[model samples]
Target: MPITTSSPPIRQPCPPGTCICNRDALLDNPAADPRILLLTQHEEKRLLARLENCASLDDLRKLQQRMEQQLGLRTEITPGHNEVRSMRGIRIVVHEQDGLCRKIRQSIPAAIRRGLERNPEVAYELLNEHDLLRGT
Candidate 1:
């Protein structure tokens, strides 16, 4: 005997009134505005901590539910809002910006070297001195 496999059948998207397929339609629609994740700085930090500490798939799922609850609370607090909405896409913008900042910071050392080439003594003095008057 030989085992055989078959792919699932492709089905048409559900009609607008019949199911929640309208949301999918909205996503595909060009006129709909791009969605933004509404998490605050504190919320984003906590969510990152939760995600980092998630040990298993089940733990991750629970964290997801908590995030959903937070989103629901936000929605209740700020009804009739056009821009802010919730989705599973969070932490991405923060991470991207962090990476950009890191790159900028890394280039600063090279910039300091260039400044030193122009005037070595003043640049070295500035780099070496730190908070002498601050009692550190």
Candidate 2:
């Protein structure tokens, strides 16, 4: 004897105001923003430490790649052409569509200032090694 298959049941729409089917409509709206992830203090410290350890532009590039992979943050670094090799520009790209990029960008300077206050030696080392003191 051959096995037989039965047709699957059809989905029926919920009656008006009877179900929460309209919840999906909220997702369809264009104005809805993507969820943003705010970094904790510990995470920010870790990021700063990693940045402080960058000895060269190549190291910074590697750190940038690691940040993208680990934290979903896109970092762009522009090298300066001065007596000391320094970062001409540093910015976080909002390519992930998350709203955290702007906050992170705003907080970076303050974080760096705090870190420098805590340990000026490390900051000096970073400046001497990677020329990351001028524009950044």
Candidate 3:
């Protein structure tokens, strides 16, 4: 069985601010071109580290803002929270820190992937080669 890709590459003019990754190159040769993976891994570490060190809501907000500026993502901090009911309708309190953690886990990977798609070169520079981790 062959892997079939469905989305046809659009040849129409690229919008002014869009940068399309040469996905064909990436898909054809991943390990041979280690840049994209390295970049993504680095961004993931940076974002996760920042998220972990957030001491308060304000700190989290600042980190989220920085992420937004860097990657065009708006971190939605639903302050003064409420309860999320489970499938069984049991209300689970949403603590601010827990919410922040959830956001970090979800957003960091997304931001990393977006960063890779946009700027793999920077990503590779930021990551450690032997470990695939973020380089300080």
Winner by TM-score: 2
Q: Report the lDDT tens digits of candidate 2 across residue range 1-136.
A: 9999985332233355555423234336667432223345467667777665555445655776776775556654332344432222322233434334444564554444454445555445555565565464
lDDT of 1 by residue, 1-136 (tens): 9998984332233444544324354446676532222343354455555554544434544654564464421111111123212221111221121112233223323332343344444332332343222442
Cα lDDT, model 2, residue 49? 74
TM-score of model 3 (CA atoms): 0.34
99-124 per-residue lDDT for model 3 (tens digits): 12343345554543454335444334
Judging by lDDT against the true structure, name the best candidate.
2
lDDT, residue 28, candidate 1: 64
Q: Model 1 RMSD to the real structure?
A: 20.6
Local accuracy by lDDT, each model: 0.35, 0.48, 0.41
**lDDT of model number 3:** 0.41
Residue 43 displacement in candidate 2 (angstroms): 0.9
Q: What overall lDDT, based on C-alpha atoms, would model 2 receive against the true structure?
A: 0.48
- Give me candidate 1's TM-score against the actual structure: 0.26
- Consecutive 10-residue window with the lowest summed lDDT within model 1: 72-81
- The regions of model 2 sitting more than 4 angstroms off are 1-38, 80-96, 109-136
